[model samples]
Target: MASSEQHYILPRPEFDKPTKVLIVISPYYKAIADDLLSGARAELDAAGASHETVEVPGALEIPAAISIAYRQSNFDGFVALGCVVRGETTHYETVCNDSSRAITLLGLEGASIGNGILTVENLLQAEVRANPDKQNKGAGAAAAALHLIALSRKWGRSGREIGFQPEGIQIAGKAEGPTTA
Candidate 1:
């Protein structure tokens, strides 16, 4: 397949308030992981955002690590970085799909997360995508998280209310009573 020559870059988000981010990386491929981490850190630094990095065993663990950090830490956003190169076994598909789904679910739950996990057919493809001077998927993921965090702050709430509540717009906590005509 042919790749697009045009590169569309979005304006980097600027945060009014201080932003803290957590980066969860799976260091299965040390060299590739290092490149991804380097790119992500550079983006976070440029945005004037402080960040913490943690390593997981594999791509499947990246999401769980973020989830744990999300609950126990006070990070404003998260970046998940990893590389999953396809293997002869079906484990490749499982890792890619599960990790992605977990990240999406966390995002839907109001967590600002950027998925930097690369699913590639070979190590060469992964290297190209993870390279800082190449695709720089790592930096892209960090930017995604920052944008979401900015949007969340702009909206004043992280999540939306689903279904009608008996009292007020808040979804959390119990409603006092059901009032209907």
Candidate 2:
């Protein structure tokens, strides 16, 4: 047997360019949320992305706002940033579960929503994750959304392709034109 080593080649994908995005945040933990938003804003600014940051009452409102923003069709993606710290009551569980599920469903239903909600037992963990230099979750969420958007574009779907083109320029394989009767 011949001994040989093979090198792997990596391919770089082309991005769809900077686009408008929405960041829905919860005011539950204003301090931590501020940190998260700052991190996210830094990344967006660097990428020249047009974006809006909206504050909701809590994590529960994040998803609904996201859905509304998506329906409005003004943004290419969304960042769902929130923090839920467990307390003595059941409110924590409800917020965590509902917020997470809503975000998941939003992602599944042709929406590019990055789940950045931090459900932790205490404020320290949330701070660690949301802090600009500590966790950089804001940047992480933005990157995730951007990466997903690129993947969607590469797959020939933008989560809004529900019909054919008016000009009828069907994108076919190398074999060629559309066959018609």
Candidate 3:
């Protein structure tokens, strides 16, 4: 049903400067992770963006890895790739929700992130979504990050200065006041 639905994909964004991305993956399902990584790599290559991949123990650690990278590295964007298949316990829900929320919080903090972590009911669904020839959620995630990166570059800075203007500084072409000392 999802496959039948029409989806609008945006044109790949162009970068004026060299773009670098960090991909953090949790390879719990090695096969699925491979397919997702392949798709993400292909998409990044097509957009002329370079990327580096790092592994973590599981899905919950993906966001933490990205957060660390965001603070320590100079990557322009991040792609989070992993598969969380529902299990017998409530742990599945926790992993799915918490990881997603953390990624969202990172994005809100001005980190350009594309979340490709798959939360599915079963392995079959994960396989379908992770397959490069099928859903290609990995590529989709990369694209999302790229778009956000473009937006960040576009409006990242404001020409106007922030905070209170210093005393004796000119305001609106007129001097605020006399300079002291």
Pairwise lDDT winner, candidates 2 and 3 = 3
User: Which digits, one per residue and each the tens of the lDDT, describe model 1 over residues 1-181?
Assistant: 3134557889999978899999999999999999999999999999999999999899999999999998888999999999999999999999999999999999999899999999999999888888999888899999999999998898875455645556444344544455587
Q: What is the full ranking by lDDT, best candidate first? A: 3, 1, 2
Deviating ranges (above 4 Å) for candidate 2: 1-16, 157-181
**Residue-level lDDT tens digits of model 2 in 18-72:** 6778989997888998998998888777666778989999999999999998887
True-vs-predicted CA distance for residue 57, candidate 3, Å: 0.7
Better of 1 and 3 by TM-score: 3
lDDT of 3 by residue, 1-181 (tens): 7867789999999998999999999999999999999999999999999999999999999999999999989999999999999999999999999999999999999999999999999999999999998999999999999999999999987455667777788656777766578
TM-scores of the models, in the given order?
0.85, 0.78, 0.88
| Model 1 alpha-carbon drift over 4 Å, by segment | 1-4, 157-181
Predicted model with the maximum TM-score? 3
- Candidate 3 lDDT for residue 20: 99
Q: What are the C-alpha RMSDs, in order, of all predicted structures?
A: 4.9, 8.7, 3.7
TM-score of structure candidate 3: 0.88
What's the residue-level lDDT of 40 in candidate 3?
A: 94
